[model samples]
Target: MRLLIVEDEADLASALRTGLSHAGYAVDTAATGAEALAKFGVHAYDLVVLDLNLPDGDGLLLCRRIRSVSGVRILMLTARASLADRVRGLDHGADDYLVKPFALAELLARLRALLRRDGDTGEPVLRAGGLELDPASGEVSRGGVPITLTRKEFGVLRYLMSRPGRLIPAEELLEHVWDEFANPFTETVRVTVGTLRRKVSSPGGTPPIETVIGRGYRLVDR
Candidate 1:
């Protein structure tokens, strides 16, 4: 596995490079955020170990920028142990966080966890026909235009997009979106879908989210 270590401290960076290399990963170290981004642009990395205190900018900013162009998993490392800092890092797009003065074993374990998560999971982006749903940004678009959708609307759309051309019952959608707390017989699913269709489909046209009478819905091929 190829990994990028974005850290400013030369000694710490070298130690990580040596440790990860010995652990059977191809390691690349960058001393600054700029260098990290430049390396990322050229070479695809399996995971990124980003230090929060960088010489150029905050690691959270770098994480967001990387997520904008690539879905690479990020593990944040920093001395800030406050709950707020950790929550902020995660909210910004970090998959995991490790506080400074951490053991090498824990770091390797976290790195392995990130890699395993990435490999086992299929593509996060849901694309059916011309419609696309990005779970990270909760953004949907058809062709190229942005399609604004509420949280529930995006959840319904994402679930449908996950299984294209398959009839998904309202029960399944409710369970998937609302964690089985929603009553499928209610008109909640239909109403949300109606709003979603209006936002995603072109005006005066058939929506991509097709309703199957007495069965469920399907995202049919155009």
Candidate 2:
């Protein structure tokens, strides 16, 4: 899943980004509300880890603004542990609330819970042909054989599976699977897709991924 961390503390933001990235999420960081909004405009994130104490504005206002535009899950983080603060944050449109100085494991657990709720719409496990991918567990299997994939490969496959049989351009995959820091001119998408194709393909069987001439890639359902 893709996530945006909106925190003013440089160390905290960096730590979250690094930790989440390692945990198989595409993550971006924004230190201010304006920056967060700008990134939100450009990317579709599955969740937002927002700090209620932003430097430029109230996190509640930002949360409202984000809620106005999308149904993306919001997990509000703050130093305030009062019931009133938590209630206020949820009333402002946060899906979940997390107090500051919490353990990373707890934060991950909260994120998984929110994502599970989101996936209650019967999309928790994405499937095409003999391939099966569980976003919540970060597990992929083809023909009952488990396959290991890099984070980017998993992101690409998940995005493709989300819109099965639809042709997705390389640019679109790059935009969604990679963050703003990726080099736009790089052929990373092609490379990643190639590797993913090899890894997910079952022995002596047709690959589920299709490449169209001059178009992008598509996930075919057998």
Candidate 3:
């Protein structure tokens, strides 16, 4: 998923961007509330890691602005640890809150929880045909056999499974699965999908992902 980190602290923001990117997420950073909003307006982020204090304006107001435009998940990150502060953050449309000096592992866990709650499907494990995907554990299996996938491959499959039986264009996959730094015209999506198809297909079984002429790829029902 994609994330926007709105933290003025250069070091912390850089660290978060690097860590989340390594953890298989497309992440972007903004130092000011204005910058954050500009990026938010352009990108459909799955989540926003917001700070209460900003160089341009209060983060709480920014949170309200973000809520006004989209229902994207918001995780408030600030040094304010008081109960009242947490409550206020939540009241300002933040879906989750995390205090400063928090462990990266804990932040990741909380992010996952928020995303799971946002998944309107209400199902933790996604199933299509003989393929099963557990988003929480990042696990996938086919016909009861384990299958290992690269991070991008997993992201692509997850996006496809999120809307089963629908034709997904290559541009859509590139927009959602890849970060802003990725080239829009790159053949990376095609290459990744090809590899994913081979890995998920069984020797004597029908392929689950099918390509359409000049359209895109679709995940077929088993």
Candidate 4:
């Protein structure tokens, strides 16, 4: 998963970024609220680790602004442990809050919980670049236009859209969606992804599923 860390303390930010990256997450760092806001505008991140004590403005404000625009999961970090402060953060749209000087394991556990439960209302759409999918109705669309999809096509597109830009292997895909009993063959992945690409990609356009030479396919957000 891709995550953004917004904290003013240089040491803490670097340490958290390193640890999270080691734990198999793509990490981005922002030392201030402005930087966090700017990064939010550009990239689609799975989660945001926000520290309340930012250089420019309060982290709560940045969280509110982000909640206004996107469905990104947010976990607030603060030194303040008062009930009032926690309540305020939650009321302001934080999915979860962690007190400072926290154990890395605890923080990671809370972050996982937040990511699992956080959901956005309004149009149920997962979008990347021009591609879009509606999980509820099993509908696919590109650039605000609707498209038809088979059951497997919808499932593949839904999984890809869930983690935009993340390289998901065919083995993982098969184990999760197809069947755990199914053999981990690369060909199944290639053919499924190929059909998905033809449907989702523009006419004569490069497929969004990037082929890593040794690794698996990644859904390019661009």
Candidate 3 overall lDDT versus native: 0.88
Q: How well does each candidate superpose onto the true structure, as a TM-score? A: 0.54, 0.89, 0.92, 0.57
TM-score attained by model 1: 0.54
**lDDT, candidate 2, 85-194, per-residue tens:** 99999999999999989998899889877877875213668787578998767899986789999889988998888778889999888876787788989889999999
Instruction: For model 1, state the Cα shift of residue 97 in Å.
Output: 0.2
lDDT values for all models = 0.78, 0.88, 0.88, 0.74
Question: Listing every candidate in turn, what is its Cα RMSD in Å to the true structure after a full C-alpha superposition?
Answer: 16.9, 2.2, 1.8, 12.9
Model 4 backbone overlap count: 0
Residue lDDT tens for model 1, 1-222: 457899999999989988776554557889898999998986657788999899988888998999889888899989989999999999988899999999998888787667658542136666785787665445778888998776677667766776778898876666445521345568998898888777888778788888888788888757
Best by TM-score: 3
Record all residue pairs in model 1 with backbone atoms less than 3 Å apart, i.e. clashing: none
RMSD of 1: 16.9
- The reply for model 4, stretches above 4 Å from the true place, is 118-222
Candidates 1 and 2, the one with greater lDDT? 2
Q: Pairing residues by index, what is the TM-score of model 3?
A: 0.92
**Winner on TM-score (1 vs 2):** 2
For model 4, how does the per-residue alpha-carbon lDDT over 1-222 read when each residue is reduced to its tens digit?
Answer: 567889889999889977775544557889988888887876667788989988898888898999998878889988979999999999888888899889998887776566556542113567774787655445678877778766555656666777778888765565434422335654766787778888788877877767787677788888
Give per-candidate clash totals. Answer: 0, 0, 0, 0
Residue 192 error, candidate 1, Å: 56
Model 2 — TM-score against the truth? 0.89
